[model samples]
Target: MNIEELASILRNNYTNADKGNKVSAIHAFGVQYANEIKENNYLATEIIKKSGLNESYSTELSKGIKLYDYMKNMSTDVENDTEHELLSKLPWCEIAAIAMYKNDKNYKYTPTEVKNLPLVVLAKKIKKAESPSIGTELRECSNDMTTDYHRKTRNLFIRENDLYYLSENGIKYVEENFSYMISDDIDMPLNQILYGPPGTGKTYFLGKIKNQIMEYNKKVFAKKQSVKENIMDLSWSEIIALGMYKANKTNSYKPNELYKLEYIKEYIDDKKENGGATPECSLRSDLMRNSIKCDALSESGKTGNDYFEYEISKKVYKLSQNGIDMVENALSKYINPSDKKEINEDDFCKFITFHQSYSYEDFIIGIRPDTDYDGGLKFKEKRGIFKIICDDALNNPDYKYLITIDEINRGNISKIFGELITLIEANKRWGNEEQQKLTLPTGGTLCVPNNLYIVGTMNTADKSLALLDVALRRRFEFVPKYPVYDIDGIYYVDFLKKLNETILLKKKKADYLIGHAYFMDKKKQPKLQDILNKKVIPLLMEYFNGDKGCVAEILKAADANIVFKDTFHLEVI
Candidate 1:
């Protein structure tokens, strides 16, 4: 019903109920209100505002309403009568924390564990559970309600009395991570297209995915014997030194604490007085070899033994139990390192750009001219990049592979993909019953493999997303990458914001706005005048189709240098 009616029911219920039942009555009201709103935050907020509840009680009730809605609509099977009853009995904060972890693909808490554990103990268990990714450790703080700068900066949860709750920033973080887009399906597709204006970092994002794939491949091929050798080469003193470093760095005595590879190598170099003389790659390889072994043991449940106990998260690793104990014993004596570097390895990713001339023959398979016997030209069957990657992925099922197509919308999709478009659907991949293959003109059959993922970057500035081919649209998940104004160290943030606003107001489309990359420099910060003169002004001129006055007006509104006389001029010089 309406907010007023819902608010009146809630107010009356709490007022009439006994003190012991009042809290339960409030929670029940929250559930009822959430059902009525169907997870609409505005309606819930309105109802809470109209209820005349105290600030603290209203905030708690609001969280309960959101938690109820999230749990009810989540992918997990929580619709059964028994599960529903159990959920209704649990505290809202506890359920929120559990629901958060459950939604993450990394965490694997069982249904039995969820039902049996108390909130405080469950929080501890979740902390103890090893997260596969680095820089994702749950941070704990004292109950004194002090400001935690790190947690505040990272938008991570705050722990008080062994229980976790979302901070103000953490709430936004949770919503972004947990909420599904309207077009999103229950199962997120392996094929995704990141579409946005040029320079919005779509390619940059794909680069990150490529690195992750390479890391995955490294882990898949890691040798246990090599790892054992690396660890065995280190003396007991050195091993204890590394372990103590990890413990002090992470503030964790856990068996599988993660540390960065470069940090460990630097510590070793400093300890040896090498004056940074060691080859960087050799040090990195040695560190990775050992860490990969630790990861293997951790995954196989062989950690916490006499030989070793540790694991790698990305390029970071935790030391063994023996190391942690020794470090704990000498906690007062060890010194922490100051410098840290992120790890990067050899490339295994395939990159291609799609254009008007790109075709199915270029993407799948085609016959190419080759020298035959007697020096006569003859056609030979040649496999395309897509087919090659698919074959490789099929052969190497244990490792992940990625194919990135830049400027995907620039090509004629139907002409490029042809019948193979149907083969890319999630169900039509190599292993499924619905898997289908197409016979190429060259006489071989092809099917996209499940282990191979396709990521494409589409520039909206080149073409509107609405005009994309429907067949291609159905197969790939489209993620919108928009311009970011709040990036640190970027010049002219306010000007970019205003310029985009003006463009949107004039053109009625966001696709034509300038992207943040124009103002960014990888090696050094770009001069604003140079950007305005060489990049921004020309782009604006192109966007306005040489209508200098219109461009001048837009620039004026954004507080940029503009001259409007008989001829419009950008006063960058």
Candidate 2:
């Protein structure tokens, strides 16, 4: 490939390589921008700048690099030709693309290579973006969330960075309207709507983006539920899954399984990208540490278990120590209204447990208020206030609870989120409700939290089914779900993404593949083939066998690929 060819390829795929909002990748990748430069121009300039030369020079360098990389890594040797001379002029090798040719071609260079070109380019960049720290946070909510995967995928918006994972179209929308999108009132407590026709893969793409963010360098939370194979087995499947989870999951745990896997995944992923080990590191066996032990692993199977109650007892001891401190300092701090006492231990522990296992319902509506704050305030009168709800409890500092309602529109929004109409905003929270008493048609009283973030999802089709009680709408920030594809390395995440695409294209029925829970798995994700074999084919029967698709109808949909003589043997096209 010559310079023009190379620049053409880069330009064509630049947007595709983006896999995300072009603006975000440009910013994160350090694309240079001036006041007059638009997002595309800005990115173009950055690519040109990074090529170690000007735009024109960069184009030539990129082409030469592409050609050199493609040929240098070829199985057959490149004789001394213009190619060799061009190699010197070429910029740094597209090391990833060359590796792809080597692998896909099985080291047998042919007339044409670049079979694994996409994988190589993506993996290379992904390696750079993979980090333990969350650099930025972007909020996105989507509609058409019939499937859980759709919602979970959007949930990945909060995974990390300002990069939100949405479908390509969603990304384009943001790219087109990048300026107005960046707003201070992201959490305006308003119900933002994203409306459009069906079959756009709106939800599917959103999930893919979200999954990427969630798994970004954090240890996957191996909750008790994920260990379906029995934690004891630790099969190749489970071990690999655990390794990935550890590598991608957030680093919150003191001794997480993912931390152990981080070095391994990083080392292995690097080797694959760079082709064998570089000078600095080698893929080693010692990378496997015993931090994730079967004996130490809790019954839940994801995380290490507490042993001899020592870990448990250690926490208990801390509590006791804190209690002593609180008791010793209580009278001086608690009695005096103006005392400058810091939050004691008792208050700290309570805050830690807030919103740990909260659900969609908890966010839209307030928790049932407590009937016990006795500073001459009656329980019924203080029902609208959060302080009254925790009135019986000590006056301890609390974490502002945030409830992220994934696909907030999917449920019976009005019924599911009742009475919260009056108390969803931060200002109108706790003591902000002007109404002393607000009751719902369902006879439920609505209370709002002062420190609550009711992040929600709204699909346009479903948006008709209103969420965010008019009161709740006024108090929340509604960020649109933007789809991002360019996460650097991942080629196909949220395998159901394709299925969701298929569902969108077909628009005639449900897509079993894109389940919301699929995106929530903190660890190993089943492949598309696996889903086809397991869930896709089986659940699809609900469609084929249901009244809509009697025996003959299934045959047509199967396109002769599926022989549905009976249930299990049903073929897949």
Best by TM-score: 1
At residue 372, give the lDDT of candidate 2.
55
Q: Across residues 216-306, which tens digit of lDDT does each residue of candidate 2 receive?
A: 2111111111122122222222333344333332222222333345333433343233233341231111112212322334445432311
For model 2, what is the C-alpha lDDT against the true structure? 0.33
Instruction: Give the TM-score comparing model 1 with the true structure, all chains together.
Output: 0.48
Question: What are the C-alpha RMSDs, in order, of all predicted structures?
Answer: 17.2, 23.1
What TM-score goes with each of the models? 0.48, 0.31
Off by over 4 Å in 1: 1-188, 223-347, 563-573
Error of 2 at 459 (Å): 9.0
- Quickly count the clashes in candidate 2: 35
